[model samples]
Target chain A: MADYYFKTRDLKVGYHGRALLENIRIDLEKGEILTLVGPNGAGKSTILKSITRQLEILGGRVAVGGKKLTELTYQELSRKMAVVLTDRVRPELMTGHDIVAAGRYPYTGRLGILSREDERKVEEAMELVNAGGLGKCLFTSLSDGQKQRLLLARAICQEPEILVLDEPTSFLDIRYKLELLDILRRMAKRQGITVVMSLHEIDLAGKISDKVLPVKAGCIYDYGTPEEILREDFIRELYGMDRGSFDPVFGSIELPRPGGEPETMVISACGRGIPVYRRLQKEGTPFIAGILYENDIDYQLARHLASRVIREKPFQEISVKVYEEAREAAFSCKKVYYTEIPWGTANARLRKLLEEVKGEAGIECTGLQEQLC
Target chain B: MTEYSFHYENVRRRGRYAFVFTVMILALLLMAVININTGPVKISLKEIAGILFAGQTDGTEYDIIWQIRMPRILMAAILGGALSLSGFLLQVFFHNPIAGPFILGISSGAKMVVALTMIFSLGSVGSMSSLAMIGAAFAGSLLSVGFVLLVSRRLHNMSALLVAGIMISYICSAVTEFVITFAEDSDIVNLHGWSQGSFSGMSFGNVRVCGVIIALAFLAAFLMSKPIGAYQLGEAYARSMGVNIRVFRVVLILLSSIFSACVTAFAGPISFVGIAVPQIVRLTLHTSRPLIVIPASFLGGAVFCMLSDLIARMAFAPLELSISTVTSVLGAPVVIWMLVHHCINS
Candidate 1:
């Protein structure tokens, strides 16, 4: 029981027990964050709703704190878990403070009047989400980000051991997205709350989730640690992405590279080549990038965007073999763009390669902005 | 800083409740006094106060006040309060402010059933029992509620639902008219005025029975304010907050039907008090919190109905209007205003 604080066995979930997704299993320890990432209509929200008891599970056994969810009454379940759903609520004449205070439903008396301690909890929850300033404003009048924070404050005030959210970051700008996920991460660590949520932003999911669940088709495509599950191939397969490539290390996705062969060459290092690659990709021109160490920041993106890549070992001197290959590729290209790749002693050979490429015909090396325009 | 603003809002909320409740209660008292004083006999205010407070009997005035005016005024207060509360419950259930027993055809259904029971009994036994009337009214309320629920399964739009309700109301009224047209002429003379709706001719027995039922139903509705408040956020959130949505919804419908049925059983069918009174109360209080709005709506309804009943009784002495006539004239404008205001804002 201590090994996994929350676990699901062969969970089957869907509307009307028709089983849109089946045979799902999850094992999560206390204080860990698990995220579901997938494309639209991929059953991510269904799984979250089923686990939180918002939707009835078609078939499964979910046990939280070693007690079966099916056996727990709503009152008991509410004390053990709280959920932030994606449904829009437009309650009339209610302030943000009143909305958050409603989270103490399980603890409040029959009339739901708040006690002194309950009020304190509401305040603390609002403060935790940085939404205390919005306490007096009508909920309907709040901006999208402020409303999301208020919702988080409400969930926090519930004081549950586990928190479940479905697309909590939807409709929020980047700042609010980061702020909301950061608050969730802090809650999980500081309060030992087990978090299970679905996010459309895969990059944020990969960054904050301790366990990543890839939901697609009709079942769990993959479920494991971020390092194991968030890979270039896995993301592409899971989302059926035909238009972009995902970078696992940076947790970012790039649109499909230009389709044709190399028409230009860019000599860059230490991430300077990334902007040039993006511009050329946007303009639909195929290009080559080279003379980059295997571990350089530019190589991370160039590997996906460049038609041809010349790479050498990391932390090693520029080898004559790779340098010759790069010089020949640069000479064959019609234009060469240089994007101020800083040179160091270990790669002193790049200067010689640049000088040699300058003597070639039909190939001109210039600054990236001037050459592109 | 947050604490300061929260406290400020709390103070403002309390102030609003105090002001609205005080104003409504005062209006209810004034209307009750005016209703008693301004009949055909024209009793003075001094006489009314004396008779009401000191139990002074002045023969004809005492007879009028004790036998007719007192019972009618109490019934107006009780049934009117019941109607408004029923409307508030229906609005919450349907998530539409325009939902009310009269507009939703619930009162018309009850009116039809009561009319049928009366005509059947008049032919057989020449009389109708109060219990039988109430029972028939309850059954009719449930029937109409059942129809609305059925139509609701196919129609999610609020205006479409109201249109269905209006159609149901027309059918019931038509059937009632058909029954009246075929009935004995003697019965039509008595049934005609009642069918049109009035607060006249109420006895102490009606005041007592309706008083008890409306009181109990109002108490039950008041107790349910917690769940009602949670439900205003919508069902999914309410369920997550530990409310049992299925049981809560059924109880809401049952309570609303009972309240409206009591009003129809006693007063035939009063229009617009259910929808207009609650909306006015909410607008005045500037809050939709069920805890505050339920009781405030009850008081507001009492004031609105008592005044409407007074106008129905004295606007053209010896040629009194139906209670619905006055209510429709006064309450329809408020309802229209709300609709226009809602459209503009939304």
Candidate 2:
């Protein structure tokens, strides 16, 4: 028998005849906090939902507590497992208590009425998530952090032996994110429940999770301790975020590529966004831009080197859709410089576009003296 | 903070609010009685007491008070509670406040079948109401709720589901319009009266059928507090908490449809009570907990409908009025008041 409390063997999950994830294998045991890390749309959530029986498994079997997932009813599953999804609505009318009571659905009788023990479980769950103060607060009134905790309390009230969460820290501030991850880690340890969560924050996931499941390229790539897989290359490829090179520091899975505050970002366009991209290639800078009309030599150059662009005719009259795209690109940069032959004679609307978003992106028009003709 | 302390606080808070809700229910019952007794005849305290206790009845006035008005008044109260409570449940199930019984086409679905029976039923007077109710209930429930549930499975957002539900209602209306012209001239009168909706035709017999449905539907909704409350957080979380979401949603829509069918079968699709009343209750009570909102809505709906029914009958005098037109007149301003009040409070 496998020592793992839950295991997936070569799991492939799909819905509506479309495959979401394929060929994945991993296992987790009690008293473990396993964090799943990947960018959005990477099938991390699909994997979690599959295990929770929220979605059907297309070709693989998920076994929890040594039983096939398909075998358990929702009530039966609730006895051994619980899950929290990132999609949340703060219904304006419900106090935190009412929200928590819902977590007892599995235990309640056919009418789904609450008993004293169910109420006790609800209280216990709220206590576990540190959302006790918000019990009286209307869900709509609670702040992002408080609502997140309230949702966690609602899940804990179910009192399952295993809990799964999808992006529990997605929109949270840094302080709250850390606080939430800390709470999750403590729950797994204190209660000996298995905790599986998907996190965009690899740094947090590394620090907290007992086992880190890094999903990528339609499969769970690695599942082990954080010290075994939080490599610099691993994080970069998982999110397509690149700011550092892989440096083997403490051990096999450790890469301590130094951090000294976010470097000042500068974007170039007319290939203006491109050369600056190359210029800062040696140093880590975050910038994204894309194709300008071929008439714009700088934009052509940018078109060559840019990672991707919202490219279009450079000087044509803008439609609402095109204008919106251009507006988004202009505002995406921290500071933009129109560094080509700074032709001050750009079209009137184009100049206005530059001005309107100048405050937003902190654009400084350079090379203005460069002749237009 | 640790998880233990958090749940402790939420549970305590729920207890406090439950107590407050119980008080509100009592207050609603008192208001219901007051509204039930007040009317155009303006029988003073002594005369009203004599009519009830001393049995000093003259034929004409006795018929007006006992036979004509009381049944209508009670119908308003019962149907009001039933429709509004059903609206609250449907709105929660779809997570759309605007997703009322009529908007989903359930009421009209019942109407179409009732119209069919009124036009061409095999039997005459004695069999018509029961046959129409069976046909209305089957037609109203199957299509409206089934479509809502089916479409909801495809679309995730509450607003999106509401849009689908509304569209279904329009399609049903078009079909019902096609069917209306086929009825005989006498059946047309009955169809028209039923479609406009009235408690005026209701007697002790009509009340029995409608009242039992209201009671049974309220009981179903009351038993659903746990699942209904789960919907507040959202479907995703509800699933994670081990709720059989498909089953919960189906049952809620079924119960709401039955309530909608009942109202339409007997009283016609008496507008606004279902849609507007729940929203008003939410505004006044300041909470959306279905446990609180559901029962409160039942009482508030009853009281408002009773009061509105009184105005419909006597406001124009001699010319009997359609209850639906009265509710519309009464409903529109209440909706406006709620929106404006909400803005002010916020």
Candidate 3:
């Protein structure tokens, strides 16, 4: 209990005193980034709001730095925790500088005026987020990406030991999303700021979070390192996603493979077959992809988008049974498209299968074209 | 290099605030002089100065300047500042630019109770004390504010909130009118004048009472500028910044109610100044940092009301228009302009 910088014990959180999620537990060392990933409206924000004391905790306890959360005055808590909320802040007539300077609320004097040192800190935070030029811009006029950056800068300047953000990347584009996560990562690792935030982008969450908590169905489904919690089966069940597949290794999502038997056979190696598989998937062509090593990058995607995948063990010669299976599948298809392959010894058997299928009646074989024509 | 730019921006902002305060103070002083000078009896500025500063009081000009015009001008300035500050607080509380004492029906609510007290007290006791009238008005303001809060909880739309406020204003005004219609003929004369809103018939005593209440409330509000600034970001952020929101909200309601109630108790329900002055101040200052906006709004409100009172008195000289008529004429356009400008921007 004392080892963790922030911990929640048997916490129940919800709205209006009704528990939406119960028996939740969280523990983090100083500077550890804990991300909450869940299906929409699965009580991720409820837990966050509870921890921040924005919403009252329905039951149990939250402690920070060994002090009970309920025991800390808002002033004491404010110095230790700052939040960037999902709520849109439309402060009239305030500049980006004014907005960021608000982060010094706890430290400022009676009137909240920024001193020279406070101004320097504001500027430094802005520069840290690459928002130095935005200081003069009106907050309402900035693009969503710019606004998100300024808000992050606002949180950064607060100098909190624990920073809580609710979907900080919701409004940002990919570029800003990556930039924001990178800043959060750097802040957590270098400055040792503990981060607790909910993210819609689970892939990005997995990359940046030290620990990922999957919240679902009124409780924490699992809480562990991203490597432990973000498995394909768990992610699928966590989101109740039946139509598509999530790739844990590459963090890629693929739509459900097209229905029906194979109409085309794709022969490829390495990563050459990815685009072909995607194109075929888009066209609703249930294709067979094969004669590749299990360790190949294409194999990862083929398993998702291909109707059937024929494969060889990594670093092993293509077995006779596998080649027979590939030839049979190729003959069954009307067209066989083979990408340009560097035929090493292990995959030399694939070249023989391609030759046999060439010039066969009703079995058309062609080199993969850019257009997939 | 970044530090240099930030320093420059900071200095520039300070300079802008200083320039605006200087301009508003000049306008306030100029308007006060003009309001005193341009009343029915043609008191010259030289005589006015002598009567006001040099204590040369022996003539009718002295009576008009000291007794009639001085109290009226002071009432306009004090109540104007109070009303504007009330509106500024409401705007911050609601996170809506259009929210104000008059628009939210808070002033009308205060007016209803004050009107009821006036008629009943006139028939029973004789005259109402300034404190009693303020107390009645404050109760009424809170009642109306409570209703508005209820409506706001159910309907989160900005237009719906405005509609609810307008409906509340209509209901309160109707009740006040119903009470006024049954009053004695003599009471009607007094009630009619006040119900329409005016700065006339003010005494130094009224001025002192209102001045003290407003000054104390203004000081309290100024002291709260730090939390108010935090709140401008929104409730969640404000709370995270260590503002005890429930307590802060109650205080905001109480202070704003005290302000509008004081105005309604004295000058009836002066429209438009509450909503318009703060908006104009924010635009002129180009920032809503409450520390700056609170004082500036107070001063701006003072200037706005003084100018409006001057117009009300001198517009058709000797016929004296109601203050609300002039303020609405001047202020409604500013509100419209703000709405249009806000729409285009957002």
Q: Which candidate is the best by DockQ?
A: 3
lDDT of 2 by residue, B247-328 (tens): 9877887787777777777778877788798997787667776766788888888877776776776688766588888988
Any runs in candidate 3 off by more than 4 Å, and if so which? A369-373, B1-6, B121-126
State which candidate, 1 or 2, has the greater lDDT.
Answer: 1
True contacts kept of each: 0.62, 0.62, 0.74
TM-score of chain A of each: 0.94, 0.64, 0.97
Ranking by DockQ: 3, 1, 2
Instruction: Tell me how far the alpha carbon of residue A340 in candidate 3 is from the true structure, in angstroms, after superposition.
Output: 2.4
Q: What is candidate 3's lDDT per residue for B1-346, written digit by digit as tens?
A: 6634656776798999999999999999999878888866887778888888998969999888889988999999999999999999999999999999999999999999888888786563138888998999999999999999999999998889989999999999999999888888888888888889999999999999999999999999999999998899999999998999999999999999999999999899999898899999998988898889999999999999999998888889889999999999999999999889878877
Fnat measured on candidate 1: 0.62
Please tell me which model should have the higher TM-score, number 1 or number 2. Answer: 1
Off by over 4 Å in 2: A107-129, A219-222, A234-243, A246-373, B1-61, B122-127, B147-171, B174-178, B336-346
Interface RMSD score of each model: 1.4, 3.9, 1.5
Between candidates 1 and 2, the DockQ winner: 1
lDDT of 3 by residue, A148-213 (tens): 889889988999999999999998888778888898989999988999999998888889999998
